[model samples]
Structures are given as structure tokens and as C-alpha cells.
Target: MAQLAVFDLDGTLVDTPRAIIETFSAAFGSLGVEVPDAPEIRATIGLPLQRAFGDLLGVAPDDELATRGVRQYQIHYKELILPRAQELLFPGVAEGLAGLQDRGVTLAVATSKFHASADALLSAAGLRDRFALVVGADQVTHPKPHPESGQLVLDTLGIPAEHAVMVGDTTHDLKMANAAGLRSIAVTYGIHSAAELATAEPTWTVDTFDEVVARLDKALTTQDQGSAV
Candidate 1:
């Protein structure tokens, strides 16, 4: 069976913590609220914008406020944060992705970011054409940890959960993978610490993108050998 590798965009593939922090800070400043520290903003990286903003601001974000915040963030992001796309691509990310693609493994992105923004970032990072499928938060009725995004990607790729693995940097990714009955691998270099990801009980945890590729190669090799036997 053909293997499928689905990735999370923000912390997993791209190190967007700095951009996100600055954007959120600008957004909150516009709203007359003090911005939190980078670590606090980074912790909410994988969640949807509204929830992330709410968590950072320490209040329940109504639709209007959330929408405004997102807009403000986008404005700031385009002006100041977007130019850092080059810096956002983590080390070994491009090589790892190219290695997977070369192996004929289907690649896809399932992210909580908006589709257009995700596309722009991927394009800027030179990974836009790498993924055969891309599913953003706005494309699904339910977002991460809900399984819908992963399910949609699988359905779009015409692949089954058994032949796929979800790679992300957060417990939210593991939760969604578990919900979809797919194996998950968490990366230690993302926003979440190893201890936090351990709570989600991913199938594997690795320190780098190259380590992720190594683990997947091992898993696939073992499965191939087992089938031959």
C-alpha cells in the first residue's frame, strides 16, 4: 500500500513562533490589551485563532472580537511577520519533505490556519507544491483534535488511515490522529515540550525532522519485510 504523510504547518513544519508572537502582540495592542510573553503565545500555536487569542488575553473571545483580532493579526502579519517566512522553515524540514516525496509517499498538510494563509506560507517556504493535498481549518466543519481535517485529507488522497501517519508538534495533532485511527508522531522542536506531547501518547516522538523521516522509514521497512514474509 502507498504510504501517506500528513503534517501540521505551524510549529511542526515551520517555526512560526516569532511571527505569531509579534502578530498577536500587535493585534492585542490594537485592542487595548497588553500582549503576553512569547512563550505564552507559543503555547497556543496549534489551536484556532479565536481560542489562541482568548487564551492569551485571558477572556472569552466573542465572535466580533475574535474576528477583529484575527483581522488585525493578519494585517500585522502581512506587513511585518510574513517576510520572515524564510526563517520559519525549520532546519531539515525541506530535506525531510523532499525525501518523503522522493519515496513516493503521498504528502499532505492538515492545519488550523486559513487556507490562503497556509498556501502563501507554504509557497514562500518553497513547499507549496510538495503536498498533494492541503486541508485548512476553514475548509472543515470541525478543526484539529476533531479528526475531520485528517479524515478530509485521507479522503482527498484516497488513502486509508492504516496506511497514514500524522506528524505534528502538539498534543492536538495526536488527538486528531487518534480520533481518525491513524498513527501519530510528535516532534520535540515545536512549541510543545516532550512532556506535554507525552500526555497525548503519540505512536512516536522525535527530536528533529530528520529523526521523523528515520522513524517512518524504519516503520515502512519493517512492514514491507513483514508482508513479504
Candidate 2:
């Protein structure tokens, strides 16, 4: 069976903590609301923009202020953050992704970021073409912790859940993967703590992107063996 590997963009492949913090600050400033500090904002990294903004603003996702915050965030993110945020791929990401491609894994991104921003940043980093598909928050009706986004990637790749793995840095990713019935691997170098990720009970947890690649290889091999039986 063909193996599919799904990834989360912000906290998984790249470290955008500064960009996220500044963007939230700028958006909140523009909207005349109190902006959350970096650590508070970091805690919400893997969630959709509306949800993150809502949490920061102490409002519901559908609240008008939250909606306005999302709009302002996109504006500032594209105009100010995107251009200034450096090519910030986490260490070993390029090599790990290349290794996965070399090993014949079908790779894709399933992120809570807007598709346009995700594409722009990936292209700027020269990593856009590596993924066969890029599923974003705007592309799905529901975001992480829901199965829709991962399921969309699997459906697009035509890969079964058993043949897929979701690699990310938060509980949201693990929860989504679990809901989709796919194995999950959590990385520690992003926003969440190893303890927080452990609550989700992922198939594996690693400290580096290289370990993620290694685990994927082992997972596929295990699947092959199980199938052979």
C-alpha cells in the first residue's frame, strides 16, 4: 500500500512564534482590543484563526469581534508578517522531508492556516512542491480536533487511514488524527509540551524532524508486515 504522511505547517514544519505574536498584537491593536502576550498566543498556535482570536479576545468563534479580529489578522499577517518572517523551517525539516520523498512517501500539509498564506510561505521556503496536497482551514468546514481536515487529505490522496500518519506539535493534531483513525506522531520543538502531547496518546513522540522520518519508515514497514501476515 502507498504511504501518506500529513503534516501541520505552523508549529510542525516551521517556527513562527514571533510572527504569530506580532500579528496578533497588530490585529488587536487595530481592533482596539487587548492583545495577548507571546506565551498566551503560543498556546493557541495550531487552532484556526477565528478560534485563536476568540480565545485571545475572550469571545466565541462566531462573535462579531472575533470575526473582525480574524480579518485584521489576515491583513496584518499578509502585509507585515509574511514578508518579514524569515524562512523559518524547523531544524532538519528540509532533510527530513527530502528523506520522506526519497523513500516514496506521499506527503501533504494539513494546516489550520489560510491556504493562501500557507502556499506563500511554503513557496518562499521552497517547500511547496514537496506536498502533493495542501489542505487548509479555509478549505475545510471544520478545523483541527475535528477529523475533516485529515480525512480530506487522505481522501485526496486516496490512501486508507491505516496507511497514513499525522505529524504535528500539538494535541489538536493528535486529536484530529485519532478522530480520523490515523496514527499520529507529535514533535516537541513547537508550541506544545511533551506532557501536553502525551495527553493525546499519539503513536509516537520525537524531539526532531529526523526522528519523525524514522518513525514513518518504521510505521510503513510495520504495516507491510501486518499486511503480509
Candidate 3:
């Protein structure tokens, strides 16, 4: 049985919705572009900044405006929002991670955020020690939905894709897991709806982190049984 768990950071284990919306609002405002509404910004949470800006403002990733937008967003997020914002973790996140760690399930984080930011957030939340590895979008040639990021995490962990499951809150995570030939599980209480997540056709869907533990237990059991057979 596989003993590895790969998780997405934002929208999966943590809720940064308000910070994200405000950051984008500030970024676009700085560039004199129309600020996208909360829902519009929310829809692009898991994507890279360049891509998100491209999708929302039609700014090419390499364009100077896009570069400025990303810089502005980061400035706002890091300086204004991050320090004062009360970090919000989804229910069961700490418990779920602890349970998995107790069971000897090696854990890692794969996020679209930069490595530094991901590290700071996890450390701030006291979850930095729980993961064996943390891979960010900047570390990979391609980001989520591209499979490279997830595969990089697997490679670093020395785990076979077949022996791992990816847990996240967006289609990007599911698509990346599927493309990497790994099982995927989606949680509905994050950025995307169950209906939106269903389009990615994850192996399982759950409403809570407690359900995540249960599902992993079932999968581990099934994997063990199959091995015995």
C-alpha cells in the first residue's frame, strides 16, 4: 500500500479567501484595471499569478503589466494582509494531518504559491513539521493541472504515483493528480463547489477532513488487501 499523502496548501488545508480577494483587488487597482469581484478572483485561486492575471485581465504572462500586477498582489498580500490576517484553517486540518502522521503516512505539500510563502504560512500555522517535503509552483517548470508539480513532489518523496493520493479543493489539483496517475480526493468546503470539482472526476469527494481520514483508511485497507491477494 502507498504511504504517501500529497496535499494542496490554499483552499485545502487553509482558507485565505479574504486575503486573496483583497490582494487581487489591490493589484488590479494599482494597474488602473477594473477590479474583479470576489467570485471572479475566487475562481482562480489555485492557478499561478501570471495565469490568473491573464485569465482575469487578459494580460499575457510575460507582459509588464502582468508582472506589475503580480508584484502588487504580493506586496499587498505579504505586507498588508498576511501579517494581520488571522490565518484560517479548515476544520479537521490539524487533526487530519496529525492522524495521517500518526499512521506513518508520509505527507507533503504541493502548492501554486512560492516556496517561501508556503513555508511561512505552514510555519505560522505550526504545520511545517508535519510534511516531509513542500514543493511550490516556482520550483516546478509547470504549475498545477500540468502534472509536473505533483510529479515533482512524488519524485522528491521517492513514492510511486500509484502509492499516493492527492487532496485538494480545485480542479487543478485533481487534474494534476490524475495526469500523474495518482488517486485524487476533493474537499467541497474550500474555493470551488462540489459541482465544479465533479468536473475533474476525482476518485473520491468528502465534505470534511474527518472524511478524508476515513477515505484514506479505506484506501489503505483496500491497497493492503490487494497486495495480499
lDDT of 3 by residue, 74-134 (tens): 8877875456433577778888889888988889999998888788888877899999999
TM value for model 3: 0.91
Question: Which ten residues in a row are the worst by lDDT in model 2?
Answer: 220-229
Give per-model TM-scores. 0.92, 0.92, 0.91
CA lDDT scores, all candidates in order: 0.84, 0.86, 0.84
Score residue 121 of candidate 3 by CA lDDT.
80
Off by over 4 Å in 1: 58-62, 221-229
Supply the global lDDT for candidate 2.
0.86
TM-score winner between candidates 2 and 3: 2
* Candidate 1 structure lDDT: 0.84
By summed lDDT, the worst window of 10 consecutive residues in model 1 runs over 220-229
Model 3 ranges off by over 4 Å: 84-86, 221-229
Query: 8 in model 1: Cα distance from truth in Å?
Result: 0.6
